[model samples]
Target: MTDRIRRLGMTAARFALSGALLWLLLSQTDASALMARAAAIDPRWLAAAFALTVVQVVLISWRWAVIMAGLDASIGTMRALRINLAAFFLGQALPTSIAGDAWRVLKIRSLGFGIGTGVRGVLIDRTTAMIGLVLVVLVTAPLLLARMPDPAMRWSVAAGLGLGAALLALALSADRLSGRWASGRLSGVAEFGRAVRGLLSRPVTAIPIVGVSVMVHLLAGATMWLIAGSLGLPVGLVDCLVLMPPIVLVAGMPLSIAGWGLREGAVVAVFALVGVPMDGALLMSVLLGLLLLLVSLPGGLVLAFPEPGPGQAAPRRIR
Candidate 1:
């Protein structure tokens, strides 16, 4: 199918899932009750969530900047930030990985990174993000088992975690392999060598980029916790940090279109083990996702007529 058709189909599906989620929230949940609860939420906590949200966005962009700077390239922090927002918007809104990752590559291209360099760097950026996800789960899994372990669930969590670590290791190993292949076989090996060399030769930048990437993910868990508060669930801050990311990692699987009802369902399931209602958890997922989209929509404006950046050249589209 064409990209236009896929997007339209995804839009229709997202609308349908969104409607279903809203219906569940209204029909099963006491909207008035939740709203009253939300309204009565501690102002200090809400203020902190807002502050944390801004900090999360800025720090995530900075993590990307760490990678870009390692490559000896500098994109305006504002541009990097907006582009990061755009990527997040796509990552959430689109059904499949291809479309969303494509959008990321394009946005970087529009900012003036040559296609190859943009894609190469984006790959690393995403890999680091994956690493960050693993770090979140690693820290949180033990806590969950200590408090709420089911034999089957514990086993499942362990396997899933092992898989995550393996994936991250694969990503790091892939970089070495790609670097070598870029040198030995390809026509543009020289550029690959240069980009790889530029990216790897700088340990000074690597330390901070990886560190900030881990923090960026930790902040994401905090955002999930705050959103939980928005629904009056009162899950522990540490629990929220551990619980949400793994479910989100599943939601991000390419199987679902736009994550749709699947993400909410998973959130509801995970929290239900701790006795939070499925409907209320779904409500929290819906609201958190909505806020994310609200923050990320500015990307559409940036994308409408994008300006090229200081990077190498725009990447060529795979299709």
Candidate 2:
């Protein structure tokens, strides 16, 4: 009971912080202008953005499937898609972003897989995706440095790439050392480590997962480009490619609900560096958030009628 109360308190605190930050951002901007811009956005561009979002979902789900295959738990592409969408929706709608991942862990466990296997798969998938994000930023650092003349922005880009490289190196080294420690004093730790290493050892498997992650981000960037176009913002695809990765990485942090305030703030700051208007950037980010919410609505249906797994009985009540 005490633990449950603590969890509730923490959840409430996070929601409050998310609401506060969102309100603060909106208060500082011209709400009327943002609304007008949104109102004027081209429907066709929104349609394009939605299509790109669908593609992003499919690619990401495929990546998840690949990760599961690495674990020898190979699920079908369609099933992966369903689970991904449902998890995404829950992640956004729940009090915390990790709620979706928890749902995923539960789903996997329900399928008679060990909790460790489920966790390992999720961790590897997340790690590969992060590595892909960093790679995107590193790969585009040169173009960004040349195009954007802001010294501060250049330094920021340099720092981000350096951090990304360090993280990748650390992950690789940890995977290598995990096997050595598996039979050591910390058997549990070593076991988890071995699991991570096992999933990541094969380049033939890991490379494609990373590639899919990169493709998903690219599609996401393109979706942003379409949103910018809808808002009549002067941002280009190259600008989106250069800026979106870091913005996304930051926004994905568990700091705010569904990345509401953090995403808007990041988009506004990055677009400013490239000379795009603040209002337009904020609007574009908001639109992207809305489209995501729309796409995730189907997840509600999935939740309502969750399919029973093997050796399990159907729920008598959904509410």
Candidate of highest TM-score: 2
TM-score of each model, paired residue for residue: 0.75, 0.89
- Alpha carbon deviation, residue 23, candidate 2 (Å): 2.3
Question: lDDT tens string, model 2, 1-319?
Answer: 9999998888887778778877877878887888888789999999999999988888888888888887888877887888888999998898788888888778888888888778877877787788788778778878767766878877877887797788666655553564544456645555555655666678877777878888888888899999999888888898888878878987898877898888888888877877877778888888999999999998889898888799778768768
Candidate 1 lDDT, 1-319, residue by residue in tens: 6999988777676667756855664576666765666566554555566667778778878877777766655675776787777676666666555665677677666656677667776777776677667877787777867655578878877887898788556444443554554455552544543554455557776666667777877776787787777656768777777777777786776555566566777787777767776556776677666666666677677666465445546556698
Candidate 2: stretches off by over 4 Å: 146-153, 175-204, 312-319
Give the Cα lDDT of each candidate: 0.68, 0.81
Badly placed stretches (over 4 Å) of model 1 are 1-44, 90-100, 110-112, 175-202, 304-319
Cα misplacement distance, residue 67 of candidate 1 (Å): 1.3
Number of the top lDDT candidate: 2
